[model samples]
Target: MAAIPKTHRRVVLVRRPPGEPAETDFRVEEVPVPEPRHGEVLVKVLYLSLDPYQRGRMRDAASYAPAVGLNEVMTGGTVGEVVASHNPRFKAGDIVEDRLGWQEYAIGGGPNLRIVDATVAPISTANGVLGMPGMTAYFGLLDVGQPKPGETIIVSAASGAVGQVVGQIGKIMGCRVVGIAGGAKKCGFVTGELGFDACLDYKAETDLDAALRTACPHGIDVYFDNVGGEISDAVLRNINTFGRVALCGSISQYNAATPPMGPRLMGTFVGKRVTARGFIVTDFAERYAPARRQMGEWIRSGRLKYREDVVEGIDKAPRAFIGMLRGENFGKMLVKLA
Candidate 1:
């Protein structure tokens, strides 16, 4: 075995931000590597996922999950190789996935950690397409949105990690998939590359409602919402009767100091009879095995395509995360820790 280092680098949440987080909110510090206790394994993180949800974790407020306490390692999903072990289920050199936070190494295992097979896919995928984002897309779309053939599906943040998968899955279900992306470049990728029927550039569009109405002539039947600001208002206005909406991430509102209010859409909901529900990926944890198996099959067969926008090092995580919140990342944003 390679010699274990006595110290490692970690990014800690120094202070909760009032609004969109600045780089100063996080500080990189070198700390002594923790030794594994009984039934634990020490892992050297290789890839750390930078997601918009982590932005919500920065605030000291009530949320679905606990906030990252001041001066603690910023929580995140990671894929790493076990370098030392005191547990039988995991051992030296075993690649595994865990919520190990934004650190070079971590010491914990058991129920929260699962061994990953690199042969099935690249280990980095444990944080991206074949991981949380993928699972979120699968359940949120098929189970909640329940798209049907010839129906129209509109996805916000369409070039993003979960959005891309949600759009593709809508296509496979024989729905007319229309994506709402930031710029012309991303819009082109959504329609030209990912096979979406049409993509609207939200940044360029002067009247979003007209654009949506033009693109989705039949009206939106399934709205896979990733962003929840003005974009949602436009989509809600055009929802067909009996439409279903899967409320996923709200990246547009994540960085706000005060909750941004829009026109109440209760009338639309009542008139359309829209079914809207919010969900987290872990909400469907018990069924992950089968869902992952099917996603893996689609990936292997080339039916489901994915993209990754990976930054080079752990120190870049803060900037990458901020960029993601600003709609900068093209796909899954990750920091390569190795």
Candidate 2:
């Protein structure tokens, strides 16, 4: 085993931003690494997942999860290698995945920590496709959306971590998939590479409602929402009767100082009998094993694909996260910490 360092760096939330978070909101500091206690293991972080939901954590507000306290480590999921262990479930050289925050090294033994099988895929994937984002895409679309064969599914932020998987899975389920992305590049990737029936560049399209109407002429049956706000309004406006919407994140409004007014299309839901349900990936925790196995098979057989946009270090997390919120990232945002 390699010698453990006495100190390592980690990013912590130093200020709560009322609007978009700036780099000044975080402070990267080098602190002494602590030894693992009984039933705990020390891990060396390799990759840290930068997600949209973390923006909500930066705010000191009530939500489904607790906010990141000021001057505390910013919350995030990490894939790491166990360097030392006092836990029977893990040992040296074992790769593991956990919500260990942004740090070079951390103690792991929490209920959420689990060993990552390196052979099935790369360790970083444990933080991306095979991790929270993939699971979120699987359950949120399958269980919540309940897409049926021949249905038309439109996914907003279609080139993102969860959205990309959602659209591909829709295709697998025999649905006509249409993606709404930010730029021509992302739109091209969604259709040319990911095999979506069509993709609309929200930035290029002058009339999104009309574009959606044309792409999904049969009308959208399932809408997997990732970036909410105006885009969602357009999709909702074109939804078919009995349509299903799986509400995920709202990246467009995450950095807002004040919550925007509710969408004007909710009344349409009453007339159309649409079903919209919000979900957190952990809602399907007990079924992850089988879900992951199925996803793994899809990946191995070249049915499902994933892309990641990686920044080199922990110090870059804040800036990269901000860019991701602004729709600058091409795919899954990750910090390569090791």
Candidate 3:
């Protein structure tokens, strides 16, 4: 094993941007690595997960989770190897996953910490396909969307971390999956590689509503909403009766200075009896074991596929995160910290 470092670099939230966040909002500083006192382990972070939900944490507002206080390490999921341990549950060399923030070293063995099986898949997957995003995609589509076989399911932001997984799961469930992405390349990847039934390029299409109607001739039965705003309005407008919508993140409006005016579609929802539910992945934590097993089986048999967009060095996390919010990442956004 490599000798532990005395100091490590970490990114801290310095400013809370009311609109789009700038790289200057964060401060990268070197700090002394803390020693684990009791039932804790010191982990050498290998990969940091940059996700859309982290944007919500930047605000000092009431939310499902607490805001990331100014000057604190930015909150994020991390996959790392334990280099020192004061806990019996975890030992040196154990690969683990936890919300250890955007740092090269972090204290693990917290309530949220879990041992990652590096043998099953790459340790990075502990922050992706085998982690929170994967769980979010599974329960959101299967539980919230409640897609039935032969049903037509449409996914928005169809190339993002959660969106990509949701669309592929829809296909595995025997549904006709259609994806709505920003460009032709993303649209092509989803349809050509991920096995989505069809993909519509929202940027290229002048009339999304018309495009949706043509792609989903029978009308959308289930909608996995990742990017909300005008895109969601278009999908909701073309939804079939008794349609289900899994309300995930709304990346399109995350950076808005003020909430965008809604399209007032409650009347349509009432007439059609549409069911829409918002979810956080942890809600289904108890069922993760079985769900993970199934997802693993699908992955092994080539029924499931995943893509990652990784940037090297912790110093680059701020830039990568900003790009991710701008829809620049082609797949799951990750930072290689080691």
Candidate 2: regions farther than 4 A off: none
lDDT of 1 by residue, 73-122 (tens): 99999999999999999989999998999999998686979988787778
Whose lDDT is greatest here? Answer: 3
lDDT of 2 at 276: 95
Residue pairs of candidate 2 with colliding backbone atoms:
none
Model 3 clashing residue pairs (backbone): none
Query: Residue by residue across 1-338, what tens digits does model 3's lDDT show?
Result: 99999999999999999999999999999999989989999999999999999999999999999999999999999999999999999989999999999999998888878898776778888899989999999999999999999999999989888888999999988999999998999999999999999999999999999999999999999999998999999999999999999999899999999979979998999999999899998899999989888888888888889999999999999999999999999999999988
Q: lDDT score, residue 86, model 2?
A: 96
lDDT of 2 by residue, 76-165 (tens): 999999999999999899999999998999999988899988878788889888999999999999999999999999999999999999
How high a TM-score does candidate 3 get?
0.99
> What's the TM-score of each model vs. the native?
0.98, 0.99, 0.99
lDDT for residue 181 in candidate 1, whole number 0-100: 96
lDDT of each: 0.92, 0.93, 0.94
